[model samples]
Target: MGAAESTGTEREPLLGPSQAEATVQPVTNSGRVYGRRWLVLTLFSMLAFLQGMVWNTWGPIQNSAKQAFGFSSTDIAILVIWGPVGFIPWLLFMWLMDKKGLRASLLLTVFFMVLGSALRSVPLTNLQLRRWLIHGGQLLNGLAGPTLMSAGPLLSTTWFAPDQRATATAVASLVGYLGAACSFLIGPLAVPAPNDTQIVNSNIHWDTEQIRNRIQFVLYAELGMIAVLFAVVLLYFPSRPPVPPSVAAASQRLSYRSSICRLLSNMRFLMIALAYSVPTGVLAGWSGVLDMILTPVRVSQVDAGWIGFWSIVGGCVFGVAMARFADYIRGMLKLIAVLMLAGASLAATWFTLTCLTRLTHLPSTKATLYTSCILLGIFINSSIPIFFELFIETVYPVPEGITCGVVTFLSNLFTGLLLFFLTFYITAKDRDGKKQDNAALTRGLAKQM
Candidate 1:
């Protein structure tokens, strides 16, 4: 279908006189009432939580997977690529969602998630087969990624008034972080304890196999729950709200391309996207290697799990708070750009400090590391809500499903591809350096002996 034709549908009323009046309603002594919209927001948040949970499940267990599969950092990097690889197909899905409807798109997302999760959970006899299946599952997961990403912002735009849009979007963004937090906090419990002989120095222990099984089980359970949510969504998610006859025709004739172009062409959008790109890449890469990063710092696997958890916590807190503030000020785009810049700065600082501390072998910097982590979480994640809010406010009265899909598709696609190349280069350099260092050390020791 043509873009314009695809976007054309029975239009819902953008705003009634009463609703329009309420848009500028003064804060009474009782304060603003967010009644049913809260319910809609809550559901969208749950969707975010589920998406985050699924995506993050791999990070805390990366070390365990490496040991179990005899995989190098490069191999693990490939695994990381699998997650965002799904972003490529998301554009088509977005188009389809726009052409079809929200319910159709949501159903498709659930299907992909279910299929991917089920595939990932299946045991394979050979290592190659397992890798193939896992990566395939990741691709399927990516298919659903855009749907969930779009759904939250779309819901926010449709259900919320202008003043509430930022806060609603922010709360939606927080849900995913909350999901990530839950995964990290629960990962340790899911894995079985190592045998006594496996313990090193009475503190360190590793159980690679058990961790994999635990992860598989979690994915299976998540898939089941997602299937349930799909049913609920199919039944309950509205296509459009009731509209007055006079304005309905105008709303129905709105063009998806016009809305998308408006958002994509905005200078503010580009700035926010660029500013967020680096930090998003860093976070994505860091999460994939989180276990390895924490190992040398005396953080055990169990303790390291808390890193993702706390990062999510920080993200959730900041996402909600900043979103609400932005809503109040109608500064969603500005807030997003500021948050992205702040996140990038914090990440760079943390990276520098981490390198220095490691090279100098300075006194344990646990507190410093922890502080950096919290800041990283808050700053890095705050952009999500802000971006969502900006998208909704800027693309007013447009078919939300299509607009959301396009924005998410572009953002994820760019960010994902950028990280893929960055990951390859960084891992390759680190590997070469390690190999050279080992060889030099060996030669020096032999000469001394």
Candidate 2:
């Protein structure tokens, strides 16, 4: 969270480089394997996906949600903000995942997710109560966000071979992005934009009653999926493998205090954390407000949602391919990360130009916009596995759970803080600006009379 402040001399005893290896138990590669590792990966990925889906329920359906719950742009932003708000208590979750191991954290994750999803599905008629329940549900769901994402590396370490670790992490970690992608499609398709011209008010397009009914339908359907996953986790999920899968998996890790001390002192980890967190944070934050950002460019909700869907879907496909590449080539994590960063920067620049073209005579086509989204998504998102691997390798013998959790927790915190202001500066301010423009026009007409 801060620049490296401790000197090497001061850091050495607090589980620095010299002492860090001492914490790890001697490890051996074993021939024994479990047939159930794949199932465990599937469950981890699925829970993460569901958590991501819950986080994004509003972004793709902002208009309908506003109508259904009497929400302002600010209110919608708050719900998205909660996606990262779950990280404020990052240490607690990290300790649970790291010290308590996978099953304890997973148990808590299911509990929070069930309560969160179920709260939203309640058929409450009171608008205020409905809003409260949704927000509360988001908060509880948010609490699970850190564990959902960070568990991938831990799960892989516990259940996968040395050769398969990075790939396993990639498959589990990136599936959450897939969950986000699915939500972009599901939210809009399930709660389709009304074709009717009927207006509920100055801003709302669909009837609140109709929108509410559809929203409940979506919530109930998603809740059914949640119930299924909850049952799966409760019935048979394991804390970890009975035997270590690889040498790295068997290492003892430093205590949290020592790990934090070493991490804060290590300049390389600091750089990696920054490189890993900031861009991803911005990407996640923007997804929540994409509808509002695209409105001025004449993009519809369905189009925006699909763009989001492709962005994430393309990224996941590209990520899986690149993870295999990284695994095959070895030691190219830094190169891969840098190249993707450069490409992503260019794609983002082009994407920004396409969006701004709406203000110019040469407005870009939808094809240009969609292409930019795909390119940006693939370039920026494809490197996630590399970064996760880099983080793990950079700080070996440090527990993978906390290592991933710390970086991801920082990313989520950055996102929540970013969206909080984005709501004020972009979404809410834009709405106020429109009202002011309308008032100014009305006054000018009155003066003319």
Candidate 3:
């Protein structure tokens, strides 16, 4: 078969001759099987898992850095921007994925990840240097994030049959979340007990700088593993299976602009984007602020780290199960919307309770807060695989690279903007309270005068 073309406005049948034959032939009589494809899927899942594992470790460790550097809430907030900043390079690389192919892109991403992680271990003399190195590391990792996030769906679509695509994608995506969980879980264990309160209070002190060095060393090792996988992908990853001429020819092709225009013009994309963007934005903000928010509630740093770890665990389990259920019921869009709405509601409840708890000076409602957060994690993450599948199905048979790039770009862009705005809003609220307090003080002095 010639190179597969990009998808277009009109829907075309995805069933190649093999699929059609399978429908007609007895299941036992079918000559073709995809045993090798399963192997590829497993490899891709591991790559995704490794990528996520590395990326999420920073969240649990952020408080330690904050204490080390004496960073305020605002400074910490600025740190979160590194992810979106890193995304710029990530998106640029993704645009090239179609022309470059999966193996090349995956290797480049892993290289960046390794480089970033290694650089993060370098000791800096001052806060400025520390900020630069840390954020710069994050920037590189962000570039890798999109590649890792999209790799699974693309692999599943290319390798798996239509009937099995959703399940395959779910499993791969679930692995990524599990990797994130593992990162948080591992980070606390990796660090040593510190002498001063900085590490103890923040729950992030690398007992010795050696811990950071060890992480970098492990990242370098993982880079070698990625290189091995890249070779495997090149040798084994199927571009497209052999197919009949007619079916191959009929696969609709369109220019990139045309495909994008169709996607943009679709009302469904807008609705899904809006619904999906909210929880995504919330999660980004929550991940950044979770430690800070817990401070007032007097939750220990270790507990906070565990909370983050468990949140990812809940998200991974719930997201996978829900994605599978959506496939089973054939209600992918509905399931995504419902899950997102539920997440938003849970988040709203959590935020409201948090504010009340703060104002009332009540005992830290850690259990309630953590429970809500766990549910929030699950529901928020549930939308991702669903959204990914919907984008592919809705824009039937597009070159997986282009389709994934466009969808991820939109989701990341909006989510980034929302996070920025939300940060601004929260900052403004704090400033307003300070202003009110000052005004009351001035009024009292004026009355005495």
Candidate 4:
């Protein structure tokens, strides 16, 4: 499928593939596309899936994680926020990819992926110790975030032809999202939310024998899967295809610094980046804390899990279809992007209104809540591939890895800030409530006097 040529109106100077590539035994320099590229894509997509699964392990199971580990909402937010924090060294990893190639960068990914799960799977009775170990594991996993999140365009460009790049990128990118979707179900099913919280040091800490055991089981399961993936990738995956798939696949790229400068200066690309980041970031942040947000509305953790799972799954279904549509008619990129963004905006507003617990006049039904969430997922998640393809088209001759990397970075940054701000707001609300309680008690004492 990738061997077919892309039909479009474009002009370009053809400079062939790079010179400094690993030319292994039993391979030729012919630029013919190969079927094995799909296999490579499948493997890379698995990495995407597992890494994303690891990242979201704590979010959807908010009550479960809290009940099992005695975690605060702030703690939960901090755990889920690690992915963005991991991107601090993203440029260093990008440098590794550019110099050491895709294979080395992916190795770093699998290493962190498995290692993080391993740490989380450790059995420890002391709550502080167990929580710290889990934090360590999450931090290690965070180190893998940039590659797992940003490498979609790079992987697709490396293996697939031009005509299939958009769809390929969509699959590679959204598969991680699918893993995230599955996480919503897996946590809820594996570990049922317990009815009681264990009190420790005069504070309410959610923990029970059953809940803790189930949480450990979930961690162990993830570790086992990641270990298998690591072994498979190490044994078989290659850095690049034996032959280039297309002109873009084979073509040399601009320097990393030069590409960043060009992207930074380009107004069109910046607008696209901004458009892509906001809703995407908010939805992601919102989803990560879905249980927390919906708790005030009386939604159970299990129900929130289902909502996240189906919403993302539905979005992925719509996203893949839209990606194919994007491929079929490249000219309609702008219109399609506009329509999806508009739909996403309305869906987000609708979901917000439906979730408002304090608004006495708003219609806050579970039915409307679910519908709005699903619609948000479809419209927001579907735009990812479109934006990726658009970025590459807008900044031709720049490497796909760099462009998508920066794009993903912006989205993660927005997500991180939103998570932090929301957490802070919640914490401050608790403090204010405590202060008012103390003031009321003081007034009662004065009246007795």
Candidate 5:
């Protein structure tokens, strides 16, 4: 719960010039074995994937979730925001990791995720009660978010050789993104498509029975997956290997507060963190509202889901390649991050304007939207692993988990603020327009979809 300070007298060397070089450079021969680190990476990566699965579950199915519970766009948006809102828990859990080590923190994460999944799936007739239960479930799962997000870099540092850390982290990150992509594909696949006539009549709004049935099907599958993973993690995963896999990981860890202070004082770290915060927050917030943004364009939920699917696919392919290249080159991390962010920003801006202008019917415009989504995914998501690796590189000797936790916490705060305003602004605008053309828009919207 509380962090203990490492006094100067008791503290290990703060990873100065000599120590930094020794830890970060490759020491092992090309043929050297990596021991059980690979197995550990696999286990943590599964956790990352499962966390991704639950985090975006409602997003791909946002429309169904909204209809099933009769929630407004604003109300459903709150569910997505809960994950970032768990920033407080993020700090506590990261501290837990630093104080208690990986196994305790990881077990804690699994417990919250499983318990949350079970609670969320509780079938109840009272709509409001069911909504609250699901909200509560989401908040619990949110507590696990920081742990999973930060764990890849930390795990890589702990369990990989210097040359292997970037690729290992990239692979772990890839699976998590893969889990998210599957959610987009899986959410709609689990729910039968609305009848053509029903879609034309009511804008793809399924009957409550249909919505509930689809949601139940997905929830049960999610629960089953969680149960299996829980067993796997508990049985085979260790707190750590008896031996340290890398010199960097074997180095002394700074106290939590001290690490925070160090990062705060570092101008390069602060600058990069600020720049990195924007795309990460924007992309995540935009993902949550994708269905709503596409509503006026009449993009069917299935089509919108496919857009997400392809976007994440792009992220996986490019993300791994970029990370591995960074590992090989071992420089230009900042320049690479900047170029990726620039590309993503351009793609995102182009897509935003097209969607807002209601240009979906234009063949060229639709193609543009899909292309931009994938490009945005590739650029933004690929940059994530690079920026994280750069963060550790810049602030050597600071434990990967703590620095990553700090970065995630701050970026998520920005994300929450962006979502808060975006939700209100869009919701208010939509509400006002609906008041004037309620009947005509309803019919037209249905036909458009």
Candidate 6:
């Protein structure tokens, strides 16, 4: 059967296959098209948000977790590796998206996400067992990364009209960043600044009990939120519309093997992937080691988390706005990406300089850092949907699942590798004022606090 027949949508030949050629596009008998697509976008965006939260869960609270478990920075570093670790499953999930469609893929994704959180929240007297369970849980949750990350392009292409595709993709993708933003806010609030009320022979001491309780609270809270979202997804989210949303979607999809091969050979696609990969990977690496990197300057987890929150807010707002603007002015996709990326680079550079030097002690440092973070967030996030839409447009006829999935996989792989190695370079001053390994670095951080 042709694409139209398979999707239960009628089509008529138009300018080209690249252009949606449907004369009577998918609509209800009442002539209203995609009455539920917006709802669908909301559901998928929520999933994307949860995925981001789970991925960055350890970052904001790394110090508390370290003090609680006596964990090394390397152990915490591995948390970021979960994304790369899922690459094998990522390939399988993409195949599922192609062969079985979004419904089956979403089911598999949600299952692991919930299971992972539950396992992580599991209480065990044996610290080693508890640690391993947390690792196992993160691993399971990692499997959902590609699915949520790719949902923007997959759902946008499958549900929206050509005119609205980029904006939808942007909104969905931006929510994931919003999740990360919330993680930063939630992290510090969950584990508030250590109380410095105690004075023992001219020494200020921390309130450790409060930190432990906060960590426990954050874990249970995360599990509760995941449970609620999981129930909603199981009951309401559809795999796809009964009728195809666009002529491009009504057409048969390319084989997974062929899609991969085509992507591998496409220099433009690789370039686009590379352009996105570098800044995003650096950002990921920075977020993972944020506490460690800022340790010397005495930046608290709450401060780090708040910075992240502001950045994400900037990213989400600009990301959606930029995507809508790109849709309005259709042909300048490459130009938009370039300008935004440059802005991100500048912001990251400025933020780095401010933190590295004692410039943060200067009166204007906080304002500078916040502004730079917001700009960095805006530039990096705003460019993502542009890249997603460009990738699909450049590689016409290939499924959005494959196009977006490959890019997500590559970016994640790069991020994981970058973060893994970046952990090595992070050093801290011990109680005796000597530079030491990450394990000692945690102790150093504790002493400083």
In order of appearance, the predictions have TM-scores of: 0.78, 0.88, 0.75, 0.89, 0.86, 0.85
Alpha-carbon error at 405 in model 1, in Å? 3.9
Worst 10 residues of 6 by lDDT: 1-10
Clashes of each: 0, 0, 1, 0, 0, 0
What tens-digit string does per-residue lDDT give for candidate 4 at 318-383?
Answer: 888998877767577778889999998898788777766478468788788889888989998998
Give candidate 4's whole-model lDDT: 0.80
Candidate 1 structure quality by residue, lDDT tens digits, 76-191? 66666665677777657767766776567767777787787777778775877877787777677766677677666655545554455556666765676688678777765675
Native-to-model Cα distance after best TM-score fit, residue 222 in candidate 3, in Å: 6.8
lDDT score for candidate 3 against the true structure: 0.61
Q: Write the residue-wise lDDT of candidate 5 on 374-442 in tens digits.
A: 899889888888888888878877888888888888878887887798778868987887887888888
Candidate of highest TM-score: 4
| Residue 43 miss distance in model 5 (angstroms) | 1.9
Lowest lDDT 10-residue stretch of candidate 3: 1-10
Reference-based lDDT, each prediction: 0.62, 0.80, 0.61, 0.80, 0.76, 0.75
Model 1 per-residue lDDT at 216: 67
lDDT by residue for model 2 over 304-371, one digit each (tens)?
Answer: 89999999999999998988777667767889999999988998988887777646545588898899
432: Cα error in model 6, Å: 12
| Model 1 TM | 0.78
lDDT of 3 by residue, 331-383 (tens): 44665657577766867577566657657664446677777777777777766
> Candidate 2 — what's its lDDT?
0.80
Give the clash total for candidate 1: 0
Q: Residue 386, candidate 3: how far off, in angstroms?
A: 2.2
